[model samples]
Target: MKRKKVQFGVMLHGPGGHMNAWRSADVPSDASTNFEHYLSVTKRAEAAGFSFVFVADGLYINEKSIPHFLSRFEPLTILAALAPMTSRIGLVGTISTSYSEPFTVARQLASIDKMSGGRAGWNVVTSPLEGSADNFSKDKHPEHSLRYDIAEEHLEVVQGLWDSWEDDAFVRDAGNNQYFDKDKMHELNYEGDFFQVKGPLNIDRSNQGQPIIFQAGASKKGSGFAAKHADAVFTNGGTLKQAKDAYKDMKQKAVEAGRNGDDIKIFPVLSPIVGKTREAVRERYKEIQNLVTVEEALAYLGRYFDHHDFSQYDLDAPFPELGDIGKNSFQSTTDEIKRRAKEDDLTLREVALQETTRETPFMGTYEEVAETIITWIDEGAADGFVLTPHVLGELYDDFLNEVIPILVEKGYYDTAYETDTLRGELGLKFKENRYTQKIRV
Candidate 1:
């Protein structure tokens, strides 16, 4: 097979990435909690040579929790279940640092690595939902900077625990009744502002070394954190220029942080609503939008705008002049929405409805979608696309059957996978154990 030039990962947000996905005829309404549904998607992607399947999770859920958010498999549990079933495609799970303990996450991911034969990745997140703190016995979610701080320390502790034992730590020497080399075990003794984890992990380092780190941070602090630590970033660049700029910024930041910039691959999110023809694409797009009622669209907007119920405001009127930096939800999203609304002079209803019809890679024929993705990759705007199949069943199949062929024909996609590990497939270096590095030096 030709050398793989672009990396691709899939994120199935339960039934689908779209808010109205469950209502689509192709998808099962109960797909969010169904194991078979999840497995089928992963198996399909693997057959098509996709790089990874990411199971995203969150702690907070309310009336507004969309189909996937209302009830879905926790990321790690789902990935663990998928580990033994699939062989080549990477299994990446989203984990929030704010409400989790480092040791627990570390052990679980290590187990996933072991179970999957080293094809495991961790998509790290700092939960920013306003009510997420309530689930973990707190009054409010920690402020943005503080959450990132906790995230940085939380990851430090986890990585330290991962490196607790050298690769040669376990011997299993039965002749002398000696199980392992005692000198190979190293204590973490990690004392950070947020945690004080005192020793080695119960399990040894995984086959791929540390689990590959994946992050999707759009804010300055969030992007900086990713540049410093993440192996790959599921980037959020709203446009081509934005994507290129963000990619450059991350690579530069990585270089400044004393790491090879190219080691951090940036995958911009892609949602392709494709059809056989341009008219069919538009028709399908309209159908998806029609399923979302105004009430639902308002609720969706409310979630993005710091939980300020948009229902309380005039839908046809311009978005209220709420200046940036006053919300507990996603600062970057809120700011972007505000900027777009202001620039276009869009009504609240228009803004909310537009968001409801979340389409990316642009709605068009399959060939058009494929061209857009290839252009982005070739132009340095992205390493590849983190595809979020809006409605899983036929939508995902169409992409695999249609768009991939164009890419394959254009010599932009490989006919076969290059490596078993996600790190190897993405051209990332295996993480070096701290103690092992010291010994070599």
Candidate 2:
């Protein structure tokens, strides 16, 4: 099957994606806060023709929080720092609507878009951790469904602010002493249930117009929001079957929401452990599994369940019974964990270890891993993937030198960038300012 080119984005999870990655002797323990480490890795990814670099974020952390989460660069700040350093690769960073103002979020992203020559993307999210409310000065976290309701309105306001100025508003005619066309400028006097923003945004539009919108909403309400608004959707893509189901469902939802199915791209996270041989791959995986104790695994699992103390239950016994406990925080992920425990009859110890050191389908010899990736794209399971390597230093190098060459040779992936902006590279259209369209109409 002759398929179109597949896109790729790397997740910049310092240290690595594994819970105990920081403990490895090869990985720098302070990689989470080391700017030089990120700079070097980002430059390498850019040279290898990655479409973007994604920075995931969180608002709150506890004693049980992962090492990277305990101390990490603020998403937007790091993206901004990386902007001038890289040329073509998109700079995407997470920002939560639950605890941020629309005007501020809109302006900050627009600044990055302008500075990066239009290579900016915003990953919109609603902070799900209950402790986040404490940080934001609230009595309790918003209910699960209500948070989505707030997110819809919050995103609406941000988009409206982004369209405040038309394309030709700055008609810099110095001789005539005309700095801008007053008639072309528009104000977004938006008043939604959650926010009210009256703005003729201080900053102007970039070449790609507004920054690209990315969302990772896997719950029913969350997925609906993504279908309606996001330029791309991030998913877990648990297996071949699951990935296909998610891709088809998301496309259908986008069509139903009055958008073209191709407008929204699906990118599942793939944390591969690559090696020259199958034995090497097995050894690498075992090294990662041995780094974490069972106690640490249980703690890692707790984060998804709103920090529910898994230690209270019998580790060797069947998984504990808890209904609607994690509904407010990471609902879909928590539900899946519960369902799998029941379905597979896994004990608490088994489930915890499995979640902490889970192996992906993209693990094997270089050629085999390359084939699996190509199969997913050719089979319509994914538009692309977001690589979060299990072993950053070695696996990333292995993928770049080994598997990537195979994908490039087979005509499934490109080794050079085709466009300047994130939207252009992703096959998405440049967003026109709303005011400009109104004037033409």
Q: Name the best candidate (by TM-score).
A: 2
Please, what is the whole-model Cα lDDT of each candidate in the order they appear?
Answer: 0.85, 0.91
- In the range 129-226, model 1's lDDT, one tens digit per residue, is 87888888988789888899999999999999999889988999999998989999988888888999997889987768889999988788998899
* Model 1 CA deviation exceeding 4 Å by range: 1-4, 324-326
Worst 10 residues of 2 by lDDT: 389-398
Which sections of candidate 2 miss by over 4 Å? none
Error of 2 at 308 (Å): 0.7
Best by lDDT: 2
How well does candidate 1 score on lDDT at residue 392?
85
Candidate 2 RMSD computed on C-alpha atoms after optimal superposition onto the true structure: 1.0
Candidate 2, 126-213: lDDT as tens digits: 9889999999888989998999899999989888888888888899999999999998777888888889888988989998999999
C-alpha RMSD for every candidate = 1.6, 1.0
Tell me each candidate's TM-score: 0.97, 0.98
RMSD of 1: 1.6
